[model samples]
Target: MCHTGGCCILRRNRAGRRMTLSTQTTAPYPSLARACTVVLILFATAVLAYTDRQVLSLLVDPIRHDLHISDTQMSLLLGTAFAAIYGVAGVPLGFLADRTSRRNLIVAGVLIWSVGTLMCAVAPSFAMLFVGRVVVGLGEAVLSPAAISLISDTFEPKRRGLAVGTFFTGIAVGIGGSILIGGGVLDLVRDGLFAATPVAHWAQWRLVLLAVGLPSMLWALLLLVIKEPVRRHDQVFEENLPPAAGQNSLFPILRRMAPVFLVVAVASMVDNAVGAWAPSLLIRQFGMDPAKVGVELGLLLMLGYGGGMLAGGALADRFAIWRGRNGKIELCCLAVVATLPAAVMINSHSASGVMFAVPIYFALSAVVTASGLSAILDATPNRMRGRAMAISFFLNVAIGAGFGPTAVALAGDHVFGPGAGLGPAISFTVVVSYLLAALVLAAAIRTRRS
Candidate 1:
């Protein structure tokens, strides 16, 4: 390979054309082993980010019981407060990711969110807890765009699905790990384990929060060793030009890719809604215990969410390789359709319902989700990707995760009146959500095809 001062490297582009791309970061064109390590670290970081977020749901009963708040109020802590601020912070952060050191951005997010997590542990009132969640959201806002953009730079488009999907497994793993690890903490707190220690006055829920939050501060230091990977570029589309400091034109690019972004937001609403509310439904309707359900939820989420995310990436790759651009979208549409039955069955009363239905719903969800994100990465040029992802983050979180759970809680509290309402609430949410997702996904397929 021809190179300049051992800094610049020669590489082949996708179009059977050779192109020489610049290496701007510390370790340019890093080895596959190094890249894999980067992915794994980011994966772990993703796990931490999600675990911090998901702990609230498992601790929901305890928090609400102690806080004396309604489900409606709790829903804000879970989704809106976090998602909204995360989305708001992400746009500018996305612009930064495009221009500066994504490693720095990522690490900063980790430290900030870790601090926010600790705030949740020490918060004395409902208002304070809500404020803590907002900070957590603000801190977490940096991860999606920065991390996804980093992954995009590390891997080629053909393999980006699997790479991004693998990164996303952090979502499942963190979520499951939260329930798994938090369950143990929940047990200890109940047994007065932490109370017996110096922090005798601490509540069970607060202890659980502290257990997860405190470790994250030290873990953020691990990321400092990993140098930022070289930013990869498309052979045909890129000029590899740096943006003028203030010249952030993300809107035009977003407008051009409106259809694809629409699918991301709509699809995420359904996917995140289920995640936000699934556990409460199980506990509320099935009369399951928190610790017991945590174990089950952990195992099921790992299998269902982790497997689904991985499968979706691999499937998107295979379909696109075999068919064409629209092949990826078709696979996405099919995955959306596949979830419909399981979505409905999740609310069923049969013993078999919880056994089979829950996993199926989770698995098919990522099939839809992974492809949508990968599609966004596919549509946008590498230079503009950070902003693109930031926009998607805003829409998906604000509309999807942010609102998904709140909508369910409201429906249950007002429409269904608490007890029997959760099942129907979930049923109505998923069925309508998946249907809307399918219609939008189908439209995206046509737009991509044309």
Candidate 2:
């Protein structure tokens, strides 16, 4: 009897040991690999999108000069023409992202945007160019929602902020590179690189656009390398987590996220308004040549906004991690608090002061704050991420990127007019926008925390 009891205890111990080993051995799964691969693919997509958009800003004068359009018209091209279609497409694409093959959809979107970019070079009239811009915007509509949705699925709740931030690096580099490349190309054109080329008569600027726009086709191939992650359910926690909070229906989730959505929209609008109008204002006010403006302002934005983007993401991740120990909401609130002061500084007195403040503003601008987007996704279920992101994109892009530029240009046209001092007026408009963004962001923080 004693021997039998000892043998039984040993058998139970061995069984427990085997269970632990089995769990440990199976822990490393394909999801992690899929996450890393998809993030890189999404990053490339972002790079392409940003670069294409930036090219327009750099080539704005050339396009304007050649087409004989007004400042307001240029703004329309940047804002409404692009934003209208882009915003409209986001909803349908987002719905598709939630329901269908996100990977294939993104690949197709990339192809569409690439074609749009290339078309911008060949467009013969203002109307045709407008069509190309619209196409570009529409193609871009697919990127953020789909990529963010995938990232939300790939990473655990705690890691989503960093993932989102990392994904946004394409934004930083894309815009920064656009400014840099635009300036460099302008210099090349000014120096007569295109003088001997085939399209020597084709404005050097048009040539530049054609060159920058075509390379993104290569990115279409990159999509093939990405593997879609396994979709998660409300239940079936892999790490012994409880069944995650389930997704609400579309209407319910929209209502819950509305307040935050409003704030993001206002903030984005203000940010875009400032970004679009600034370079033009600088050229008009400072007496800086276009090529020179491209390089200097480009570097300023690069270091200030782009670097800030990188820093903001890291800060948000660290803050979220520290606060995630308590709650993600509260920590995100703290980030809003920290960014508020920077918004005020963006309107500081001196030009140098403003330049210094820009990176701070750009940093605080939801690039890092957007890391919380994943938290929103986590709060819901797998199926809702695309729609939620679509709503966010619609509000953010439609209001921010879409209207912001138009508003600024219109204000510059009406209030400042063609002959009036443009620089200070434009600055005033942008400053107001940044302040409003701060207020909206603060409100968003409160809403998120609550």
Candidate 3:
């Protein structure tokens, strides 16, 4: 319900002699053209952040084989190493976003993660690689929370789903781009496209890491032009330009928003597990090459994830308008339920079956992400948006990224004994986690209406 707003913020001139009052008007609330530009930039940022994160997905086999590690160890590389810090660091960073310059934080984050990614490409040992992953996690921890907070302020509540969804298309793009771009590069190098050259010194995986990670360093610069948005909640800003509240002050607020936040967490947990294990599924059961699979599925993933997110956001907004405030939550609930069939499709043994089903899963999953973020923004106040989103991201990464990938790996390695265990593990996690998410989302709607 954050509205377009006006406020009087006091500033001290360089002379430091007098307090100056600056009028904040609602007149320039990111017009459609400007909003499109903002969303495009955010979408691009999402792509970069995720591309760096998922590059490791393609490198899992090499990293594990080179390090002489177990699947569990590989899972840690994918999950715990990154998620552990992202979850905890998000709160403080989110606090910073609310209180300081989100644009600067994003700039710092892009630089940090990009450097961590480069460090990952050069790590001489597994320990060094783990440290790099931790650094990447810390840097990435600031993005979506702050981005979501900023987006919440840019668009009115009713239009929020669309704006947020547009920004998130980056997630889908980054996910697909990582595989397409990374996998394509790896395939070319392995196929000896660079055979007689000095570039032959580095391994394909290292090249893949460097290729995706390095571009983000340049992308960070684009953030400098972005203006921090005027803060609002529904139709009003708190009378005085008060100091931004701390995370501890947000606990009571967070407690009230728990049902929806928890829903987001569980939903993320399920989706992340599916995305992490998908490449392996294609490679293992269907005898597909990692390089080949990446090219083939990359387009599908973009369509599924990006297209789905756009549809979900726009639809959820309409639903909210037609049915009232809680309508958007209902759409999210349906999205969770919709994933059940997608889960079954993705876990299928046939390559064609899984391929056909995976995109559907991506599209359906978009609803949860798009609607969930919009819902959180609607429920919380403006000053608390960043921290609230940080908490949501903490839950999101802690459960989704932290546990999902690892759980799938463990299920395959320990529970199902590594042969055909992965498919089942992914399917099981999807059904259980997504079902729980659906129920929680529904309950949250009821809680709101209550």
Candidate 4:
């Protein structure tokens, strides 16, 4: 007999006796208040992860002076070193999430990355620092696949866009918070607040890394309190079935979702490229103080990118109801196209002009990013969500994080002539990446329709 929360089925056992099969073995759906709390914790954890990850951007000049590294080498520290491990580890971790306690996985990941961050603070050489970053990447690789899978099971399918969107805002805040906090810490160090402390002899950049890394350890303990929701079953039979070949593997799903994956990869490439270089661009081209740029850029990102995540989430939910599968991809395409113009504006000669353009660029990028993720969740079933997210993470870090910063640096050092062409190089990278993203998203739309 059917019931409110679940159903019971009558079955014949091997002995030919009647049996009742109940689908209520797992916990019931969480209360609204409980769900909100889960999302809040996830959001905060994401903020911490990204803050630790992106803080290096503001520390670029300081690190270079001490270690004598080139832009390309720094970019490797920024992108490839971290991404190589992050991308590779994500797949196995993702599958583990599918079979294990996601909460525990997240807690362990948080502790790991936090330790890695501390390692970066003490590293005396470039190679050691790169190793530290790789460790950080390994820890962070556990978050998205597990977190997204958790959220998907926590909320109903229809509301998932908003939930996922809210979680991603942590990225906006984390990115912004890193700069804001980094800059504030730098100011304090310069003002002699730590002059009397034991860390007085430490470099200003190392202190910043130490400060950000410490909080995450405490946060990891807090994550221990969150309960893991039961995994949801697919409502449609077809969704639960294997491919036409009857093989239980991820290959068919991956092939089917290639265009969607490419869209995410391309979007991440531009987003990371812009983020990694914007601080440097301002310092190099406009000669603004790093502290001041941090405060300003941090505010812009928190407001612009954060707002974009919320709006994109709301819009994606609405679009899903209004237009079905095609809606989210359409939104992505529009956002990608809009991003091109704002990207070109990064080359603006005046500081004010660039400032005006940056928030708009970030907001649009957030729209694409947030909506694109929602689309992926919409397309995949619950059983495969973790691995699906892992594939996306692998591609995102491998292609986007792996190459984004290096591409900009290479263009600056080689094509634009060492120190002077950062502004133009940023613009060039953004335009090319977005153009490719738009094409892939268009193809994704067509594939969905057919």
Candidate 5:
């Protein structure tokens, strides 16, 4: 029989002897106030990281024009150049998070990526901008593994879903804020708001980059105040026996979690594709002003994506109570299924139709994202979470960030014949990616049950 005070289970051996095995439990978690403060700080860091990373989405056209690059070339900047290094570096950084002070790692990451963002602001050519993005990727790579690991260690099992959800809301805010702020700044620049400043001579896009990148340095200093939590040894075992073969290694966990990784990959693929191109889609297809699109779209994303994240967290916690660990994965599957209609609607003929659809798509994707992350934390042991999350980040950046935008561009340039076909191309990417995610998530749930 199992007891509540300590995680103990009774098992019968082949010799007909019953044994009780107890997994190690740590001291009580940090106080709720402390945990909340940690989450708030981490959430702020996440916002800064993503804002620096994604602000480029709003600068695509001006950058393309200034650099004299094609959409395919620009897509390389948006996806491959950054993703390649980010994904590759994440493995080592993730392992480091497992062994080192995650707080210090994040502080360092913030400084490096902030410099990278500044580098992008002054980049004179496409090559330099690509290099800058690579630096940003390198720096930002430290975030997820470290942050998620920190969250898992600081909170108990049941409350992790909400904590993780709150942290990810930063992502929603960053993504939305990138466009909202970028658009507002761009509009202000065009209206001569910066005419008196030395930066008035710079192009609007460069100004936007400068505006977004500078604050991250100050944000890094704030992270210094976040005291690192004590590492906890939290692992659940189904039976009492010798440690399973390869238990200490990450490969076993990776192999078991393959489906979950795929779900995140495909979901990220569509999410990045939409984020990278939606502005262009609005401007080209609907004849909307870039600044106008940025404000409206940005507002919609913040509300939709942000709301979805909170809801997902709450639902994840609720599902965990109702359906055990698998509930998180079940939530992911449901979100993917619901995303299909939203995906189709993003390609609506009228601008109003597309506008209405945008929030729905973003909101649903955020749901999947929040629940999926919680599932990963739930499935991985505390000691292994940093590496596990690193692997997931690698897949997310490498496959989703590395390939998603480029795939859409290639399709638009080649299959869809450029200008006229971008809307359809985005629709195709979202629909196909989510379809695959749905199937994989369903299989994961079934496997869990078996």
Candidate 6:
């Protein structure tokens, strides 16, 4: 039976040995229940942030009509404006997560993003709404780096990929949830679902943002229960470091990560581009409604990547063990080979053709994540893990999230301006991104520790 938030309790019987579970971090069968609880909290945070982030896209037509803005202006607000600042802010937050209490930072970020969502809901002008989006990005900057670091500390390498994969499920689910839920909300408000409230149809979108954005406040409570894992002590390996050297500095870690970072950034860019542009492409080209788009994408991701991520991690780890190779290397090579088809399928003309392509794309995308994340974490010392994630995130966001969609949007507007379909244009752009990703990831695979 599904509990609150759809949690299910699974029981195993082995020679009549009974296992009881609690949601705590302490070991010797440390609470799987507690681990799931923390994951649930992180999932909620991802859901809230991602949902509100994309709400602007769904509401773009309405916002443009109400505020009288141009597509170039909308592109600016969506891309460079938010991304520039987010890239700058993410590094410092990443450093802080490494040096300080990650859980506390995550809690604060949740609150910050929630308020930003509320601001978006009530914004009066395009500039004000842009400010809200920027705030949301800034706050969200804290999450992934910190969350990755925490997962690294809390779980061992063998199982860490699956853990990270599970966390990212929040992202897939959140995006899909936003599209599906936001569409329904918009329809209701537009159709006067709450006509007695005396609010404008556009203003009702704000209420939707506020309602979906606030649940993270309750999720913040998960931090209180998670026990902070001990930071790895250099003293434990005194010979590894010079006696006079400082412990917290990350330059050493960054130096080691240079090659790996290049791969992570490019691969992630391809992934984000496919995600950001797919909805708009389908809508503009295929004439699908927002709700249908959301449901289809959400179900695809849930079944494909959402579930595949967990399986990929397990399989990669096993493959690594079987071949006596690094899991990261195996995973990267697999992703490169697997994703090539998805890139081709995206450009397919028929709707049925593209529909069949979805699972391949998602599954390939899912494999890259868990392995890449584990590799990055393994490459850095505990003190530098947060910064490494931050740097990785900055590159991914700036290139992938920022430039990916911006490029697609610009292509759609200029190259495919009138009669040219969005599917061809987006497909062209996404394929280029994926090709670049495959090359970079191949480089990463070659460099993996033997």
Q: Give the TM-score comparing model 4 with the true structure, all chains together.
A: 0.90
RMSD of 5: 4.2
lDDT of 5: 0.83
Residues 1-450, candidate 4: write the lDDT tens digits: 433156655655333444443343355678778888898999999888988898899999999999999889999999999999998899999999999999999999999999999999999999999999999999999998999888877876556657777788887677777777777777876787668889989998998888888888999889987899988753211223344211235676677667778887888888788888899888888899998988898888888888988888788767765675577778889899999999999999988888888888989888888788877765565667798899898998999889999999888878788756688899999998889888888877887778
Question: Tens digit of lDDT per residue, candidate 6, span 100-208?
Answer: 8878888888777777777877888889978887887888899988887777666644455567777777765665566666666666665766566644444655666
For each candidate in turn, the TM-score is: 0.87, 0.80, 0.86, 0.90, 0.90, 0.80
- The C-alpha lDDT values of all candidates are 0.75, 0.65, 0.76, 0.82, 0.83, 0.64
Worst 10 residues of 1 by lDDT: 237-246
- Give the clash count for model 2: 3
Put down candidate 1 lDDT per residue, 115-149, tens digits, no spaces. 88899999888899999999899888988789877
User: Which segments of model 5 are wrong by more than 4 Å?
Assistant: 1-28, 191-193, 237-247, 320-325, 447-450
Ranking of candidates on lDDT, top first:
5, 4, 3, 1, 2, 6
Off by over 4 Å in 6: 1-32, 155-161, 187-194, 198-204, 216-253, 323-327, 414-417, 443-450
Of the two candidates 1 and 5, the one with more favorable lDDT, higher being better, is: 5
User: Of the candidates numbered 2 and 3, which has the greater TM-score value?
Assistant: 3
What stretches of model 3 exceed 4 Å from their correct place? 1-35, 152-161, 191-199, 229-253, 445-450
Clashes of each: 1, 3, 4, 0, 0, 1
Q: Which residue pairs collide, candidate 3?
A: 1-234, 2-234, 3-234, 269-400
Q: List the residue pairs that clash in candidate 2.
A: 268-400, 269-400, 304-359
> How big is the positional error of residue 105 in model 4, measured in Å on the Cα after superposition?
1.0
Q: lDDT at 416 for candidate 5? A: 73
